[model samples]
Each structure stands twice: as structure tokens, then as C-alpha cells.
Target chain A: MIISAALLGVIAVILAWPFPLVLARSDWPARSPDVALVLWQTIALSGGMSMIGSLLLYGLVPFGNALPQSVIFLGDSLRSGTLPADTRFTHVLALGAAILLSTHLLLNLFATFVRAERQRRRHYTLIALLSDPLNGQPGMRVIDHPAPVAYCLPGAGHSATVLSKGLLRLLDADQVRAVIAHERAHLVQQHHLVLLAFKSWHSALPWFPIANRAENAVALLVEMIADDRARRDVDDRTLATAIALVGLGQQPEVLAAASDGESDEPWISSPERALVAPRVYRLMNQALPLSRLATMAVFVTAIALALAPAIVLLRA
Target chain B: MLRMANLGVLERLLMDVLWDSPTPLSANDLKDSLMRPGLATKPTKPLATTTVLTVLSRLETKGFVTRDRSVRPHTYTAVMTRATHTAELMHEVLGQVPDRQAALVRFIGGVTPQEADTLRQLLGVATTDNL
Candidate 1:
């Protein structure tokens, strides 16, 4: 029981702290976001499971012969309509804490999903009320907003890419196509669902640095993933310039990007300017393709990490 | 799968008719109004009443138009004033996810401060704090 508890503690600590710090600084995700995304998922899932599992195991430690025996005995005790009288106050508290934490995490996750889904439905309803179908463009809508904007609301059959009139007026034909390509990549790749998972994790472990880092990393990595997909058909320069033009055209207040070096905008406090600067930089100097061996290693590591909690629980 | 946004040209024309009308419009009334002279650009062919009904039903389902079933021909009225609906849609543009900076799929918008910093660091651009 002690061995399992210690292992769970170590695994939880690795996933919650050092792993995210290290992964956050690594440039590997830039080269291959999909693999890195998988790795982040492994850490998050396993980390959460181990945290709860370790607590439960600790709570059950004084009951039975071994870790599994204790768990079985604990289950039997609860099912038989009485908790063990031999349980200590600390043990009861630990068990109560375990149950509460697990429930809180699960409930928060569910609430996040419900909230996102509700917001999506409302957004779709609003879009239906105001947007007009773009002439000669199938599956695209033109909303008559002045500020430049383009985005896709993704649903299985209900997906629609929306471009504001300002956006169309601001960008030339190729730039418009590039922007559409980016939005299309999001729909094709189902990035929203990936984000939903990370978002739920962030909500569940609001104070954990790993949860925060995972949310940020997944958000940016998915953008890169979409950019990679967009660049396949669109020229890199065109895509980069399109991003710049849209970014610039939208924020009239941040006009200094024209004078200052492209990288300077990243230092600005405005969220939009900061996001655009790096994306522009990455497009200009694309990361080289990751080697097959490195890709395989990432996959292997992800699989092992993701399975760690399950393995520990099953072994007991 | 009828789209709520990107209303078809005919649908928009129907909406225009409903918006301008003081009273609820039946399908035949809508067709007559659309076919009238000097109403924006007309479709190549005259709109059939059945087409008008299809458009109205689609609009009704989308919550743009509410059907009045008490009358003989089943009159339809716009659920919301056009101006209010337009403003609401524009103000509530994108970012459907509940999480700030967590809506990874959105393009052409601002992210949260933390997301901005993380992205800046990843791209090797010196963030404000670093600068």
C-alpha cells in the first residue's frame, strides 16, 4: 500500500509540476504540435487520475492486507451499510477529502462542457438571425460588421465559416482564401473538442500550473496545427501577410507595428497584438519537420504516461 | 441542415418583407410583397408561393419568424426587430467557448494576457515583462 501510494505521489508530482515547466519551454511542439498535444493530454489525464487515486489509496491503507484488498474491503464495507469502526479520524477525513475532490473535479468538468455547449448553441442562434450567405461561396456567411473578423463555428453538419464585410474589404482575394483555409483547418481537425478537454482541465485544477500551461500550450499548438494545414495550399508568405493585414486592420489603436520591428508587437499588453506577432514570426521562419524517430518517441512516451494511472490501479 | 446565419437570398428578401410589414404576413402575402416593383434586386425568376412557404418555415425554425396559427392562412411575423437582432449578433461575435484564451479554434481575435505571454515566449518574442 505504501509502495503504491508513494508511486502515485511521484507520478502526480511529475505530471503536475516539472513536466509542464519542461514541456512549456521545449520547442518540439512547434515542430510537431499534434504529437506534443498528445503528450500534454497524457500528462493531464494521468496526473488527474493519480492525484485522486493516491488519495483514495491512502484513505484505505489501514483496512485490509494489501492495497487491492483494502480497496475491496472498503467497497464491501460501504455496500454492507456500515463503515469500519476501526477507521481513524484522519483516515475518515482523507477518505472524505478524496471523494469530495473527485466529485468536484468531475462536476466542474461537466459544467465546463455544458457551458461551452450552451454558448455554442446561443452563438449559432445569433449567427442564424443576422448573417447572409456569401454570394458564390458555399458554406460561408457574411456578417455586416465593420471591424475585420473571420471565424468558423464548428459543428458536425452545422458548421459554418463567417467572414465580416470589413474582413473581405480589408484583404485581397488570396488573403481571404488563406483566412478561410485557416478556419477550415479548425473544422476539419476538430480543434474545438481538443480545446474542450484542456479547458475542462484548467477549470478542474484551477490552481495547478500544469493545468494552466496545458490550456495555453494546447490553444497555441492548435493554431500552429491549423497554420500548417493552411500553408499546404497557400504560400507561406501570403499566409503570413494575411495574418498581419488582418491583425493590423482590426486594431487601429496599435498602429506602431508598421514602424517598430515585427517582433515588438509581442511585447504590447493587448492580447490580440501579442498573439499575432508570434504567429507571424513562426510563419516567416517555419520550424523544420520533426524526425520520424522523435515523433515515435513522443508517441511512445505519451502512451506510457497516459496509461500510468490505469497500470497502477490495475496492479493493485 | 438549414443555416441560421448566411440566410439565403430569398430568405433575406422574406425577412425584409416581414420587417417592413406592419401586420403579420401569410405565405401568399410574402410572395406578393417580394414580387412587387422596386423592392431590392429581384431573383432571375419570380418566386413561387411554395418557395415562400419553405423560406418562412425555415425562418420560423431558426427563430427569426414566429407563426400565428389563429388566422386562416397562418400569418408569420418577425420574432425580433431587425435592428436589435443585428446589434446582438454583432456584439456577440465569436468566442463561443466559456474559457478565456481557451478558445483555440477562433481566428482573428485577441487572446487573454496569459495566453499572449505564453505564445510570445514560445515564438521567442520578448514579452513585456522580459523586455
Candidate 2:
């Protein structure tokens, strides 16, 4: 049982730091964002599970070797409001940390969801009064503004893709369609739900640098996924052109980048520019589809990672 | 979908009429203006007074319009000019997400003029290749 606890702790640490760090630094994610996104999700899930499981394993070591038996025994002991004789202070401390971490993560998820829904409702209220529907387009609203603006407001039953008149003026008919296709891809794929998990994870562990890195990596991958989806309908060139035009063209006011001679990429200061460079790069140059073997390898590894914590505790 | 989007168009149209008016107008005045066809993506059917009232109430609640209850027939006036509302929306040209972004709002990256030139060159190159 102690060996099992030690093994779980090792898995947790690897998944939490070195694994995600290596993955983020690698260029493989840019090749097939769908596979990369799945791997990221599994890593996040298994990492949290193993971290809590390791502590719980230590806390229940005295109860039994098998997880089911140990969990039942722990439950019975809790119901009776007494600790067993073999229980050590280390076990109590570990148990407390595990419970606290789990509670923090769950509460943050709830908080993010509630907060997101409220904001969406308010945005909907404003859009309802301020926007006018496009005559031919369903599920899209056209706002009368001189600056090009476009985004999708994703909700459960209701979703809207908003475009400003300025954007319409700048884009030709095909480019306009391309832009709409891209926004529609985001809504249809339910990319917002994928983002919610990473968001809550980041909020729960704000102090952890790995948490921030993982969130950003996953965020970029989500965009790539939508881009790929959009490409299915519009040619790569058309979509790339649209992205470049919207991203790089004339703007009303832009925040001046605080230039320090040390940095190379000025776009890093602006979130919009950060998104544009890589997307344009990927789109302009063709992205070869990831090989089947590599894709399979990722899937296999992800599944194994997800099951590792449970298999180690239950059978070790 | 934009099931509520059509409603939005009606709201804006109603507000536009209010903004253009020299003074506060009753529901009938706005209704008569809207009842005419070709009001930019609005319905052509004759609007019910209750429907007009419902939209007015919504606009009033949203602070885009204010209604006076002193008269037999209540009158409503625009709270602010269209330019002011447009100006407010302009600040959010790239679409603003709330802090700790819950929704996945794709942003327009602010491209430096140099990079924009480089991208345009790249796009130009791609076009030549396609030709």
C-alpha cells in the first residue's frame, strides 16, 4: 500500500510539471491540435486525480491494500467518529490536504460557471437592444460600428455570432463568408466548454506556473481546432486572408506596446497580435496531417495516463 | 440562434425613430413610422400597439429610452443619441470579454505596421503562387 502511494505521487509530480512543460515546448501540438487538446485534457484530469489519490492512499494505508476495501473501512470509521489505532499524524495531515485541494478545485469550477453564465446573460441583454439582425444570415447580428469586430456569444440553447459593419465594409463577399465560417466553427464545436475546464484549473492554482502554461497551450489549441474546422468549408488561403485582414488591418486605437529593447516580438504585448502570428504562419504554410501512428500513440498515452492513478491504487 | 435577433432589429428601429424625433412621442407615432415598409430588415406586417408597447418597455428597462406617465397616452423619448451608443461600442471594437474570460471570445490581434507589411507580402506571395 505504501508502494502504491509512492507510485501515485510520482505520477502526479510528472504530470504536473515536466510532462506538460515538455509538451508545451514541443511543436507537435501545432500539427494536430485535436490530438494535442485531448492529451492536454487527460493530463489535467489524471494529474489532479493522482495528486489527491496519493494523499488519500497514504491516509488509508492502515485500512487495507485494495482501494474498495480501504475506502469502505475509512467510511465506516468516519461514520463512527473515531480513528483507528494505526493512524498516524502524517495520515491526518495528508487527508486534510487532499480534501482541501479537491474542495478548492470543485468550488472554482462552480464559481467560473456561475460567473460565466451571468456575464453571458448581461451581454445578451445589451446585444438584444443594440444589434440589428442581418437580413440573410440566421444566428448572426450586425452591430453598426466603424471598427471591425466579430465574436461568438456561446450559451446553452442560444448562441450569436456578432459582426460589425466596419468588418463588412472591409471584407469582400468571400472574405465575409470566411470570417463568418470561422466564428460559426467556434460556436458549433462548443469550444467554450473546453475552455471552461482549463479556466477553472488555472483559477484554482494561480500560483503554479505550470497551471498558467497549460491553460495558455490549451487555449491556443482550441483556436487551432476551430481554424481547422473553418478550413473545411473555406479554402486555407481565403481563411488566412480573412484572419490577416481582420487581425492586421486598420484599427481605431491600439495600446502602445511598452518596448524594451530586449524582446523581439512586439505582438506579445497585445493579446490579439499574439494570436495572429502563429495562426497566419500555420495557415500560409500548409500543415501536413499528423501521421496515424503518431495520432494513435497520443491516444494510447492519454488513456493510460487517465487510468494510471486508479490502476495503481486499486491493484498495487 | 437569432430568434431574439429579429426582436433586436425591431428594438433598434424603434430607438432610431425615437432618436430622430424632435420631442417625446406616443406609441402610435412610432408605430405609424414602423408600419411603413422598407425600415431596414424589419417586418412589413402592421404592428400591434401592444407589441410596440412591449418593445418600448424593454428599451425603457435597458435605459435607452424613458417614458413619461403624466399624460393620458404615455410618451417615450430617447435616453441618448445614436452616436453616443455607437461610441460606447467603439471602445470594445475587438469585442470585450469579462475579466477571467469565461467565454471563448476570439480577439483581433493588434498587428504592428511592420508585421502587417510582412503578412501582406506573404499573402501577396501566396496569391502569385496560386496564379
Candidate 3:
């Protein structure tokens, strides 16, 4: 039990720090955001697993030889209102931390979900009241605004692609089609759910470097993935032009904040400002995608990483 | 699905009529104007008074409409002009809302001028008529 606990501790440390730092610095994610997204999910799953698993195992060592026996014995100890003589203060401390960290993560996830659902409902009410269906466009609604907005309010069966009147006036018909395709990709793929997961992690662990880095990286990757989907329908130039125009009228307030290189403003805003550049560049000068063998290797690694903690814990 | 969709259309149409008027409109008055001559020519059937009332009540509960209980049959009015309401809503919906905790997935980012310049150079500076 102690051996596996120490092993999981090492795994947790590597995943939490050096591994994510190296991954974030790599440019390979730009080549294949889909595979990168899978890798990210595996890392998050395994990291959280090993973190809590190690602590729990270390704390439960005095109870039994394996996880099942330890868990059963711990319940028995609670009923009898006593601990084993081998249990020390360190074991109790580790157990408390493990329980608190798990609860914090889970409660944050639920809170994020509830808050997002409430906000989505409020947004939908306004949209329904203020927006009109675009002429001859089935799933698209046009709002009466001049800031060239485009987005999707994803829902179970009533997802909508909302465009601003300003967007239509700014771009030609081809550009408009490309913009719609991009938003549709977001809705159809449900990118917001992916974001919600990372958002919860970032919110729960605001001080953790990996949490912040993962959220930002995943945000950019999802945008790139959507851009790729839009590219399939329109030529690269058309998609690039559409992106440049739509981003043109976003937030005039951020214009000054973005130009300044050093600011303590939220990290999200700055990276988001620069997000357009890489996406447009990728569209214009398309990089060769990762080859088949490379993609297979990444998938295998992700699968193994995802299953690792389970294999460790389930062993007799 | 169909019922909810119909209610959405009706809500938008009713809000449009109320926003156009200078004074509060009664439920019957709203139904009449909605079925007014120009729109009556369309193939879609006119909404009933009960359906329009139900929608107005829903909008009221959502805080988009104000009910004038002082009048008989209780006239309704849009909470604000469409322009003002749209501007405020757009600011938040686009994540320029103060406090910046947006859950929506915005399609594009705010681009820097330098980045814009780079994209122009790469895309041949095809500034359309709008710019």
C-alpha cells in the first residue's frame, strides 16, 4: 500500500507541474487541437485521481493492506468511535486534506454548472425578446446591435446561432456564411461544455499554475478546432477574412488594455486578444496536420494515462 | 418543442408592437394590432387574445414587460426602448460586461491592431467597403 501511495504521489507531482509546463510550451497542440484536447482531458482526469488517491492511501495505511480492506475498516472504525493504535496524526491530517480537496473540486463543479445554467436562461430570455429571425436563415437569429457580434447559446434541443446586425453590414455574404459556419461548429460540437470543465478547475484552484494554463490553452484549442471545421466549408482566405472582420468590432475598451504589454488585468483578456492572430495565421498558412502514426501514438498515450490510476487502485 | 417555438415568435412580435407604440396597449388592442391589415395578408394565422395574454404575462415575469394594473383589462408596456435594451444586453452577451465572468462561448476575440496589420498583410489588405 505504501509503495503504490508513494508512486501515485510522484505521478501527481509530475502531472501537476513539469508535464503540463512542458506540454504548454510545445507547439504541437497547434497542429492538432483535437488530439491535444484528448490529451488534456486525460491529464486532468489522471492528475486529480493520483492526487487524491495518494493522499487517501497514505492516510488509510494503518487500516488495511489494500484499498477495499482499508475503506471497509475505516467505516468500521467510525461506527465503533475509535482509530487503530497504528494511526498517527499525519494520517488523520492527510485524510482530512484528501476529503476537503475532493469536496472543494466537486462543489465547485456543481456551482459552476448551476451558475452557467442560470446565466444561459437569462440570456435566452433577452435573446427571444430582442432578436428576429434572419431572412431565409433557418437556425440563425439576428440581434439589433452594431458591434459585429456572433455566438451560440447552446441548449439541449433549441440551440441558436445569434449574429448582430452590425456583422451583416460589415462583411459580404461569403464572409457571413463563414462566420455562421464557425458558430455552428461551436454549437454542434458543444465546445462550451469542454470549457465549463476547465472553468471549474480554474475556479477551484485559482493559485495553481497548471489550472490557469490548461484553461487558456483549451480555450484557444477549441477556437482552432472550430476554425478548422469552418474551413472545410469555405476556403481559408474567406474564413480568415470573416474572422478578422468579426474581431474588428468586439470591445473598444480593451483596445487600450490590449496594446499595453504589461498589465495586471485578468490573464484571460490578454490571451483572448492575441487569440485572433494565431487562428488567422493558421488559416492563411495552413500547417500540415500531424500524420496518422503520430495521432495514433498520442491516442494510445492518452488512453494509458487515463487508465493508469484505475489500474493502480484496483490491483489486489 | 413546437409550442415553445411558437411562444418565442409571439413574444418577439408582441414586443415589437409594444415598442412601436407611444402608450401602453391592452391585451385586445395588442391582438388587434398584431392581426392588423398588412400582416393579416400573410399565411400565418393571427394569434388569439388568450395566447397573447399568456405570452405577455410570461414576459412580465421575466421582467421584459411592465403591467399597468391601474387600467381595466390591465394594459402592458415594454420596459424600455428596443435600442437601449439591445445595447445593454449586447454589452454583457459579448462579455464586455463588468466583472467579466462570461459563461457563453464568444465566437471571436478582440484583436490587437498589430495582429490586424499582420492578418491584412497575409490576406492582401482586402479591406471591404465597411472598413
Instruction: List TM-scores for all candidates, in order.
Output: 0.78, 0.84, 0.90
The best candidate in terms of DockQ: 3
Question: For model 1 chain A, where is the 10-residue window of minimal lDDT?
Answer: A258-267
Give a tens-digit lDDT track for model 3, residues A1-316.
9988888898899989998889888988888999999999888989999999899989999999989999999999999999999999999998998999999999999998888888877777787778877985776889976668788888776678889887898788988888888889998898989889999999999999899899888988999999889888888888888887676555464433432433223322333437787888777678888999999999999888888888887772
The prediction achieving the highest lDDT against the true structure is 3
| lDDT (10s digit) by residue, model 3, range B1-131 | 23887787788888888999999999999988887777622218766788888989988998889999998999999998887787666667656565333457777866766776776665555555325
Model 2 lDDT at residue A149: 67
- Write down the DockQ of candidate 1: 0.20
**How would you encode candidate 1's per-residue C-alpha lDDT over B51-88 as one tens digit per residue?**
78888888888778999999989999999777667545
Sorted by lDDT (best first), the order is 3, 2, 1
Report the Cα lDDT for residue A280, model 2.
Answer: 75
- Better structure of 2 and 3 per lDDT: 3
Alpha carbon deviation, residue B89, candidate 1 (Å): 2.6
> Candidate 3's error at A204, in angstroms?
1.0
Clashing pairs in 3: none
Q: Model 2 misses residue A57 by how many Å?
A: 1.8
**lDDT, candidate 2, A1-316, per-residue tens:** 8888899999999999999999999988888999999999999999999999899888888777777888898899999998889999999898889999999999999999888888777666666667777885767888776556678889987688888887888787887887777778889888888788898899899998888888888878887887888888888888888887776554323221211222222222235334566777888788886899999999999999999997986685
